[model samples]
Target: MTTPNNTEHANIAVITGASSGLGEQFYETIAHRYPDLDEIWLIARRKERLEALAERYPNIRARVRALAFDLSAASSYDELSSMLAEEQPVVRVLINNAGFEREGLLRDMAPKDILAMIELNVMGMTMVNRVFLPYMRAGSFEVITGSVSSFAPIPWQTVYSASKAYTRFLARALHEEERKRGVNVLLMSPGNMNTEMNVQGTSTGKLGHLPYLDLKRETARTLMMAERGHATYTPMLFYKLYRLFAKLMPSALAVKVTSIENGDTHGR
Candidate 1:
């Protein structure tokens, strides 16, 4: 249970979905700061893109490995475990950043899509945590990406909201469970961001036009802050206000307001 000193406790950081968006920013940030990082394993469905990112850092290029696999697949966890044991990399930090969204009315969304969301956001994250935690060193840690939406029930983005809620709760629970074991867990609840996940021309569009959408650099900075041991951190100020307002509002009213604001079913 020793404090994590950034300068002295540098170790490998494994980031899932590192091909683009916030995950890509994290990969770049860590690679720049911890040049001697034991290894940085990037997992995503796009191996080619991951390779391009790794090539940018020739020093750590040899240490960076890309594993392309659909995390939503049924046997993904077991397969990942085998790969890790074979590599035997000492993973000191884990970033669960792989996520996606299917925008449409829930009724119009395919049942299979909903199932995939649950499998990737919940089951996949849990599986990775279970496999890598035992291998982490004494001063190791994990960061799970939740969302501001996790704080309230948002319409239209139903599955995405619920998935992040699961992540937020799971991260808090795991932090308590792993403290005695010398492991730290952090939950990163970010507001809207300019990423592929938030489709262009959509209502949840990156806050570039509004006052929110945390930039990739800033979000990565906040995330690293949390990884260094803040239990819970939100990326932007307005998001904090939104969270407070949501908490104080009645459940029914809050949902209705969110639906109208986001142009969901209730608004119609």
Candidate 2:
């Protein structure tokens, strides 16, 4: 009895880390897929970049909102919740993709960045779902961005791998928990996407280059898998093989192999 233009038909998609890389790709690519969407909420700390994303996709202007938000900052959640409550737009897609990582031994890493990795990757992701989970009804999709490092612990990037591992577990558990509610939760874990997070930075002794997937291609694959209700998606044959090897191989050996790739010979 519900018509296409009914008030209940309006829904929105929330994508974090929308400023650049895979997040930006999601902001662009996933909008058209949600035909029932009233708006797509772009959340990132950089307001300028979010605005730029809107400009790049001029056709979706009326359905796009740039919200300056820092996932690591716990206070942002209350404001987001208040706004969502006021707007009352049903969230059809929630992408908890805002995350950061510094590649190096834990001891040498900056304490602030380390804390932020946990805050955004683990705590922030959990809280984002908390605020929006109540609205995830029969058809809602929750996509959490994870990494190949999530399969197991890597020697150098200890904290980051651990955080993503936590995220992967959370996604898998939520997939089961929400199945009965008809809500779908999926974790999209990609390897070496050449993103700022993957490459870290030029200053660090990171690899000058590593085989990385195309951002747009991977993002499309992720969205496709999420639509299929896949609980955990590892795109790219290379990444899928890598994840398989990591899981089947011994933990210590996997860490050593990962350390070599990280350009960290002297594992801490």
lDDT of 2 by residue, 1-268 (tens): 1112224544789899888888888877887666657788899999997887877766653378899988889899888887766656667888888888767778888898789888988999898888887766778888899888888787777888899899988989999998897889999987666655454434234343445678777778777888788898887887788898988999988877776334532110
Candidate 1 positional error at 63, Å: 1.2
Clashing residue pairs, backbone N/CA/C < 3 A, model 2 = none
Off by over 4 Å in 2: 1-9, 196-209, 260-268
Model 2 poorest 10 in a row by lDDT = 1-10
lDDT of each: 0.72, 0.78
On residues 137-167, what C-alpha lDDT tens digit does candidate 1 reach at each position? Answer: 6577788887887887777768877888898
lDDT, residue 246, candidate 1: 85
